[model samples]
Target: MCGIGGIISFTTDLGERHRTADEFAAALHDRGPESGGRWLGRHALLVFTRLAVIDPVGGGQPMVGRSGAAGGGRPEPAVLAYTGEIFNFTDLRDELTRRGHRFDTASDTEVVLRAYEEWGPACAERLRGMFAFAVWDAAAEQLHLIRDRFGIYPLHYTLTDEGFAFASEPKALFRAGQAQPVVDRDGLRELLGYTPTPGRTVFRDVREVIPGEIVTFGRNGLVRRRYWDLPAREHTDGLSETIATVREIVQDSVRRQVVSDVPLGVMLSGGLDSGIVSALADREVGAAAGGDRLRTFSMEYVYNLANFRSDEMHASPDSPHVATMVEHLGADHSELLVTTDDLMDPAEQLAVVDGMDRPIVGLETHVAFRRLASRMQPTATVALCGDGADELFGGYIWFQDPWYVQAATFPWIGPFHGMEMHSGLVDRQLYQELDVPGYIDQRYQEALAETPLTGEETAEDRRMREITYLNLTRYLRTVLDRRDRMGQAGPLEGRVPFVDHVLVEYVYNVPWAMKNLDGREKGLLRAAMGDLLPDSIVRRGKSPFPTAQDPAYRQSLRSRLQTISEDKSSGVAELLDVKRVEAVLSAPSQGLGAGVNRLSIEAALQLHYWTTECGVEFKL
Candidate 1:
């Protein structure tokens, strides 16, 4: 919903960087173009750019407030700059007010600031929402960075020679001009290896604030304390009770999230995840607002339907199902049809990397949608989707496949190993030094250890839980990041009720048997919302976001790669074997395979563009 960045230290350069923080905040214009501001402290500086989704008139950034418990002589330690939506701000506000807290504005930002003053870092435990915020504690001379339990919001920070710098997006840190977008050997490995090593990022010095953590940077150095984590416990609820609880929590999350001062809508797909969100949103919005039609949007490739074939990931084109739901719900729907040229556009592809500030493993669709959303629904600021449902409810094909689930390492890597060569063309010694295999295994073990697999457990249950945790922490992290970058680039705020901490925690503890009941992926969810949606939608199988299947798209990529290959002084040429690159390009591609060749070409092209355009330096 907003962008927040700041620098803290005894660095004298604050004079220039404070003003540069303006550009740092300005770089996120797509994320929040409505308004912006900067606040400078003797030893700290903060910046905020806002979308103004709530109490637009009253809420603005780099806000300063006194702690509720501060004594008359004590210094007011807390100054807050935040980005996110606190769905339960109203409830928290009332409780704080009852306890003698006064408010000057009718906005959630004030409620959060007051809550922090009243509770300190402990405030995160009492709040329920997706948020990333910074609180400068002047009394302690400490800077605090906090992220949501599941990390739905993005926060990255790192210590510098002068002090610490933090930002909602990595590019903001770059714009601040303290840290370079230079990834070293290890950063390169994580970038290409397809592993989500918590805290590690593509930039050598910049790191993500791990989910559920409140990290404090001060004179004593950095300390991290986790505020919440998934608790493993025995399932006591019967099938009926579990389903009822799922329905209740999920409905409530959607109910709270749909509240917005700006235009709000749902990102609809034929899949069960988005369908259920659409259905619940429709009912909730209708009942609350005199039966207005729900607004929904879906994207499709220009000739995808004509070229579509049944694959492991998709059973049918989304057109028919989308149509069925549009008519069934009587919703206001818009379909954006994009050509292969649109998907392959170098500028659009470049925007994807620019938006992410890394060579991320996401589809080109994310980039296209960032532009499409603005054109289709310029007024729509908030949109909800079912992002984490697959990881939570076992909707992916591998979740149901015995062979894939039983593998030792992360389930996705083996099948997609070839794609892991994001920097395959890099000098061989550099690639060898990356130790992609070793890095992936190390990260996998770290994640597995954090998963509390207590009590007696069957091999099946334990393995499934590990797999689920991997998807939740790693796969889902990438998914959420991609969604944020894309949606924010559209200047639209994307929310996911399926990622509600309570819902994720509850469904996580449920036995796999219930989640995949009757041998179907997401079976419990289907049964819970069966009567609410048409059988056609509830029965629709999982389909990954659609991609352009046209050969022309592949040709466009191939041609560009060929052109770059011939350039003797190409920035990417030193790392690549031109003959080998030419061979791969000449090899057959149906333009539809989701395998090594497709991904390698995509990654290589992306890396080239990013390195050349962004002028990324390899400090290796």
Candidate 2:
């Protein structure tokens, strides 16, 4: 629930670096409207913009504490600039207090500092939550950058000739002048392809801190090490026991994340994932709040019901199911219905593109996130929802497709993504130069190699491991990054219980057979929460966040694409095949979610504006 940025460089004057840190923090002020601060030293500077989700009146950063070079004994200066919530901070604080650590603030920031003081980098292993933090260990004269196990929080850094700079968003790093936003070949592939390569962003020199990693830098140079990862093991629990354990772990994560100093609610999608979380939250939080009920929210397009139809991707619109859940739970509910006009507003769509810091296409659930966050910010500071569930529980329909499951490349890359659908629109030579398929193959191989493996496993089990790994590492990051941007853009915090590392580790090793016990996608999760939810929700097939289905939206997009094509000065002009574009404009609208031409138009326009806004220069 905050923005963190800093630069650790030996080349710049201390005052100069301090100034840069100020600018870096200023760039992300929207993320932390509550308060902001900066910490400076001879060779290190950390800046923080905080939106208080816990201990609202206290726990400001860059918070400083005392520690030893070896993490014990004589105290010396240790500065911390941290973002994201640590759900286990209360317990850790108690344990640290027992060990004689004194506290002046009732904040998780202090616990994190104390944890590092007591256990050094090993503290990351004992912590459970979403966090991206940078600590200046004055004793060791080294800086440490750490991200959570699932990469729920984003942290990007670029190493420079003098040192390195890190930030909550890549745009902050660009503002700090640590790196420029230039599109290299790989970056182009990443922008055009479904998922970017892990650790690779649209900016050439910029690198995202890989999830579960702790990167440290000192006189010895940079050293990156994994603090956590999926642990492979055999499943031994019976089906009933496994389901029971899943229910327990998931509820624990939800209850733990429900902690907040401000008002909170749930993003009720009406599907099983959000439904399960909202039900548990209502039960637990309702009891704690003296019978007060939980608040829930959902979104829809103005003419969605009229235009929406059952399709391969969406069985039905979310409105009806959402209504069922809201009535069933008897929770306070608000449904925001948006029009195509609201979605196509140039300023708003451009802002979404800039917030993402890449050439992302379409405005499906993403627009809902931003619009809902804006509306909810006044009432709720934290909103919990169901993400990471599908990836973990095999919920995506494509997961059930044997063709995708058996494919040599990542299952979600080609067909599921429509990766090659826009190739014809790209300047043929430029498209050939991007080598999209080659890039996918390489990154897919890299992901496969990184998947944790048990000593021995069945062919099906092994294939499942690869597919799950693809979802966890590649697909999931894209989803998480997008949500974080929009949620924080509203200056609101979004939490996902489904992403808790403990639950993820346990469910990961469960056999695919048990995962689909009812011969349905995400059957295990459905089984676990069945008793708490209505049969309508429990039996409902998986649905993605709703996409605008109105024909007017398609007309608006085509008009914009035509306008962009007419202006040869547009950034995407180099990528377009003029004839192909004409065909796209002339092609019949595919109504709602089914058309490739419609999507291509949307993608082309978004990419053009994103490139222009980010000041990107293509290497090719």
Candidate 3:
């Protein structure tokens, strides 16, 4: 893994423009600590900070091709700056070699450059990995940028009058002077009410290159086009065959992502996704690298053992489950215990939103993982996360609907299905003042447009599609974004093996019946687990990363709300009435569903925090 940044221009001075690229790359230095370089030309420049993952000694970027420009029978010399790992590079390289493409380095980055030279933009469709790359065409004066199909790797860009500026993170663009501090109101609504959908960021002028999409720039101006998307296909395979295929694809993905020079590990949540990854990685890598087994990391709160409980609706606590899986797998494991006080720190939410560039749900667990990354970075350069499994395998309890079973695709829509619960929790004027309906619905409509279903698509498939679509479009993006920021913030590279293209494609076509065979969510996945994970862990219901259940966390949030109320002209004050907030705080029964005691008070606090601290000025 590495960091990529660049500047493309038609008339901008090459020497001066190169400085912008340098600054952008510098801002991402933590992402690539091993080596760095810059590629410069009259009309274009590219820069890279490489963390020596694959071909440690040989791979470096901005990697310029040895050949000269096309025409005059000369091969086109393309310079590439990339940040990611191509898990299937061995196969890709063999195909490229058979086609007479010479190689000087055993690096997937080079394979991609050669592949692009051979297939142009079409190359992305054949690639199966998490990547964000930018290429400069010296002769054509054109620049090309592409992102992975699931948007696992982030690439933010800003278009200026002179040319285009891009980077692996928004902060890099800001540092390059291509970005100004403009806030998008709709983006704020999404971040506060729902997960910020893929392809949208907090920054107004900056845009994310969509998953499976390519954006190109030249004298004609910028053109954006989709290179890949989820193919709507009818499932015909039996449950057994589908499960077998899923096992093969997932295992291959895990094995391929273990191709780093630096030590690697997995975030073993003791759930099926993480457990499967840990088991496969320990077996595959231990065999390949002699006795070096996969390392594992997990987090639990202090006093968690006492607070742990399980019901039919929610699974048993993750700590014990994760412990059993780690012991069964016999992998080197480390667990960090955070206190409710640690999670309830006054400034923790602010730190998260500041680093993430937006507010997100599940804030406490996100911080815990980040703390784990910082601690484990001494022994691991990359950490694998099992993020996409839930979306692909119908793992969300909300997705078990019989209606979704018969529907064509994603049935996870209608997230705001029951706002009526808020009617008596808070005053009517407060509900109207909050205007959660107008704000949330607008963002929801925008998200639906991003992954619209056709008439030919079934309701079951549509629901499944919506779930996985939102996973890719929102949930997964948020997870990957948090992983990148939190991990790379400490110079650690976080890899998501489940987001591999091959695995994603296999799951995309598997029918909902296969995903949840025998009335079990992710039943096929469990069947495929075989000897990798214990049946107890495999059959366990989903438990999100552990967070504090203590009342201290709630009080911490209420304090922040109090602070927000004190700041008379704060952006958070505009939407939330002070009287309503006081009333809600006094009642102590709002912000949650009926029979649900504690609320997502921290989430509400972060919403207020984003407005005041992040300057998310509201237009509503």
The models' CA-based lDDT, in order, is 0.80, 0.83, 0.72
**Compared to the true structure, candidate 1 yields what TM-score?**
0.95
Q: Model 3, 1-620: lDDT tens per residue?
A: 57888787777777656567768777788778778998778888788898777888778888877564322223658788988888788999999888878888988889988887877778888888889999886656788899988777788888887888888887777777877655655544444455555567766788889888999998899999999877656667787788788888887888888777778888888788888887777777753346665688888777666876664335566777878987786778888888877676656657777667665666787677667777787778888878888877778765775654443323333333343322222234645665756765666566666664555666677667666666666666766777887776456788887787767766777767677778887877888884677778867877666657666676666676677668776665554544546654665564343321233445556656777776555443
> Model 2, range 1-620, lDDT digits (tens) per residue?
79898878666656555668778888888789889999888888899999988898888899988655433573677889999899999999999988888888999998999898888888999999999999988778789999999888888988887888889888898888888888887778887777767677878889888899998888788899998889998889999999999999998999899988888899988899999999898887853345677888889888887778777778988998999998887888888888888888887778777888875655555666788888886778899999999999999865888877888887765454553543536776787777877877888888889898895878887888788888998888878877788886578888999998899899999998999887899999988988989999999999988888887887888888889988868888988877677666774533223334555666777778877776777776
User: Candidate 2: how many backbone clashes?
Assistant: 0
User: Cα RMSD (Å) per model?
Assistant: 2.3, 2.3, 3.8
**Decoy 2 TM-score against native:** 0.96
> Worst ten-residue run, lDDT, model 2?
587-596
- For model 1, what is the C-alpha lDDT against the true structure? 0.80
> Candidate 3, which segments miss by more than 4 Å at Cα?
69-76, 287-290, 311-313, 346-348, 401-462, 567-575, 590-620
Best by lDDT: 2
lDDT of 1 by residue, 417-466 (tens): 34544654455566676677788788888888888676666877888888
Model 3 quality (TM-score): 0.88
